[model samples]
Target: MFTTRPEIAGTFGCVSSTHWIASQVGMAVLERGGNAFDAAAAAGFTLQVAEPHLNGPLGDCPIIVHDAATGAQRVICGQGVAPAALTVEHVRGSLGLELIPGTGLLPAMVPGAFDAWATLLRDGGTWTLGEVLEFAIGYAARGIHYVPRICATVQTMRPLFEAEWPTSAALWLRDGGPQPNRLWANPALADTYRRVVREAEAAGSDRVAQIDAARRAWYGGFVAEAIGRFVAENEVMDASGERHRGVLTAQDMANWRAPVEAPVFLDYGNTRILKCGTWSQGPAMLQTLALLRGFDLGALDPMGERFVHLVVEAMKLAFADREAFYGDPDHVAVPLQTLLSDGYTDARRALIGEEASLEFRPGSPDGIAPRTDYAAAVERARAAHEAAGSGEPTVSRLGASGGDTCHVDVVDRWGNMVSATPSGGWLQSSPAIPELGFCLGTRGQMFWLDETLPNGLRPGRRPRTTLSPAMALRDGVPWMAFGTPGGEQQDQWQPIMLLRMLHHGFNTQQAIDAPAFHTEHWVSSFWPRGARPGKVVLEGRYDLGVAKALQARGHLVEMGGDWTEGRLCAIRREADGQILAGANPRGMQGYAVGR
Candidate 1:
């Protein structure tokens, strides 16, 4: 079997991320005696600089960390909440919109990535805030080679920015709109981080105190002030095709903080899969796993038509539940236990037929009726999504897709591990805050305007985000941390890697290198959500016979380019202290480094 690259192996540490620069930064942190937590923070911040179109300082992240010292695993909820002033009534009555816009300040939530990384550093890391942020600051100040995709994204939105977002035009088009593969600098963003470092240094010499000070500077101090002013002054265009002012205020930033919580996990034989709560799309993967547990997956070929069809059908059922039930658990009584219960999974599993089902079927849990007009909503969203004519290179068939996301995985010699997906805050998401050099994230676009649904827009409610990262423990020990960067396809790409590793005896690189596929058969989480019934998009690497066979079973099969499916990355730590890492070769960006 041909492999894109050898699995990186090391005795000290390993790092894998969506960008080579970020992976190198993580390795540098480990080489400098930082733990996995510190390395992850460094890599994560660096990703914001290296892949600015994919993510930025104002994005959100859901991080899963495994501490080898205490043998504990925890989830840091980096997803920000809706503003206290934002409500469904306001969007519908005041803004005269059916759904929250996918771009502009109206969809901005309190920036959460900075606080989450700071929290990780404060609690589990061994380095100062200054140390972890140095790479990002340097890259932003001195400039780094821009990815071609970044140039393309900027070009696509150039007219919009020039006409409606002067601040964005000034920043992105400063040098005649950043040339592809050319070095580009964001001095304002660099200064923003530098100011935070200065504020932290002013606090004290204690590392923990410095981290806390940085957090304060971000959420309550200068950064917050700038963001507040930008939103208040700007009325920008969004997915609704109308200009609207944001309700997010400086007080919201001051009132909000990232919280660390327990991860939801499922025991599958000897492996335990961990993910964030229902506030994210993480649990859908677990639900899919539960549905898959009753089947003899080991008996089937990993890439066979039967296996692909089964996984795709199971995902559709799981995502339907996601649309109907998944939300911020703090605000709603998510029947999580019931949804994951054996009986519930059994009922949902039975719905998967040999012939692909095109209808959206959200199971009735706890006697609660699933949303009656979900298909109608999907059609509306599909119309808008198609009209927008916007999509990233991968997973474009669904959603108001513009910017993508990024992922990072790290493991240290001490067995500390972290898996994080950081996204939102694309340059095209909103006008750049001139003072900050980054735009607000439009994550609130995931919130529906329908008050009847679980993910309805409400004051202070967290959006049901699509960003999900995964961690797995084998025999009560940290084993693997993995994730990717697709909006609704995040969970779709994960199971393939896991199934291959679990059933086919594939190594990390081999599993990641395998062809991948996903179904766009559910309502997307992004703006102008779209659903293509019975649509199965597969990489061309898959056997042609399999594609024909899937079509024979009622799937609307579409063949994507070989190596176009996923940018998955993974890192594993053995009990005996060996580290192995792998990265997707697709897009020619992701890399894994170890020594």
Candidate 2:
């Protein structure tokens, strides 16, 4: 079969990521006999240096790891929570704002990526704290030949940096923000990493103790002090970004740590797919799978109009439920078991008709009423039609503020594997802290100000985030690790890749290189939230007849450039012990490397 690139084949190890440098760094760790956890941690830190516009140290990550030694699959919750002082009254009453701004300081949350990587290294790997971070520190101190996309983003944000955020301008606005031809270096970031290492080594040579010391340095010591001062001194913002003070503090950062928990999973045929809990949009994928099992997926052509229609219709239902019920289970009671029960899934599946659904139909699982602010939703949708866009998209520029996410997948020779999606704290997300050379993320924008819904903004509550990673088990053993870097589009692309592999006999690269599609029918997860009913965008490589067929069925179809959809990276270990990997070829940026 023809593909954009050959499926990488090996028995030793495999690593795939949104950026080539991160993948190479992960492979370097594996070559040195580090486990998958160590490799993933190394790669994760390198991503912050290599793709500063896409992710940073202060961002969030949700990781799924399959450990062969314990015969277990575990999830590390790298997602952060809102500040204890960021109450609904503070936003809606005192700030006199109905919605949080997409940019600026008000939407900042406790950063979780750094601690998450440290936790993984401590609990699962044999590498030292200083060893994994060395790669990222080297790139920052010397120089990196960055891609045009990063250069473009820095230039675009230069004005905002120069005008309102002088500290950011000091770093990013120099020489028009890293020229496309020259290598750019971040000396401040390098020094920051070096100082952390010094603090870790001060705790003695024991590996676990050193890792714990580094965590303290971030959350309680120098890093936290810098963030606390910066946020406390800054002003809060409305949608217009003009007034108020930031609520984040050192106390919030110190109070939080990345949590590890068992993942919820479903087994269909010989494959068992696992995802994070209802706190994320992950369960929506499981819901789609439960709904699709009744269909004769094998009989339908995976590339034809029929397959696209069935998948899209099923996704609409699943996402509708996501908006209605999914949230941080610690604060709210999410009916997950009822939502995934055989009776509820089959009943919901019966709603997919030949005609498209223009209505937002959220189901009533267990006879519970779906609580939502419909009146406010309609108003927000209308304002969205007028407001210029804002959110995380991979384009050179988008909306009021623009940024994207990053993904890494690694499989080691020891039968260990990891799939992680790390994102937020982009260059445009907020102004940088002068001392640390990074800023906080705007994931708090995902919370509803209504204070009544499951995803409402509450102090110390986790916002319903779009950052999701995925893993799969074949028969009773671990097999695939894969994910992508699109906000709502993360889960959409993976299921299609899996279906093709499961039924059409497509290899890893073939599945990743195929045409992709997704719906934009739900409420926006970013600022100026909007809803576009029955809208679908398909990669133009798919047949024109498929688009026309969908339009005839009352679906609004728009054609995108053949490569405009998603950037997915995947790696799998076969029962024969052969390792295979694949990366998206759309932008010619993502790389899959292995021996």
Choose the strongest candidate by lDDT: 1
> What tens digits encode model 2's per-residue C-alpha lDDT throughout 450-563?
767899999888899888899999888899999999888888998889998998998899999999899888777877666788889999898999999999999999999988
* Model 1 weakest lDDT span, ten residues long: 392-401
Q: What clash pairs does model 1 have?
A: none
Q: For candidate 1, lDDT tens digit of each residue in 178-287?
A: 99888999999999999999999999899999988888889999999999888888788776667789989999999999989999999888999999999999999999
The local lDDT score (0 to 100) that residue 117 gets in candidate 2 is: 95
**What lDDT score is found at residue 493 in candidate 2?**
93
Q: Give the Cα-based TM-score of candidate 1 against the true structure.
A: 0.97
Model 2: how far residue 586 lies from native, Å: 1.6
Candidate 2 deviant stretches above 4 angstroms: 236-239, 373-382, 385-399
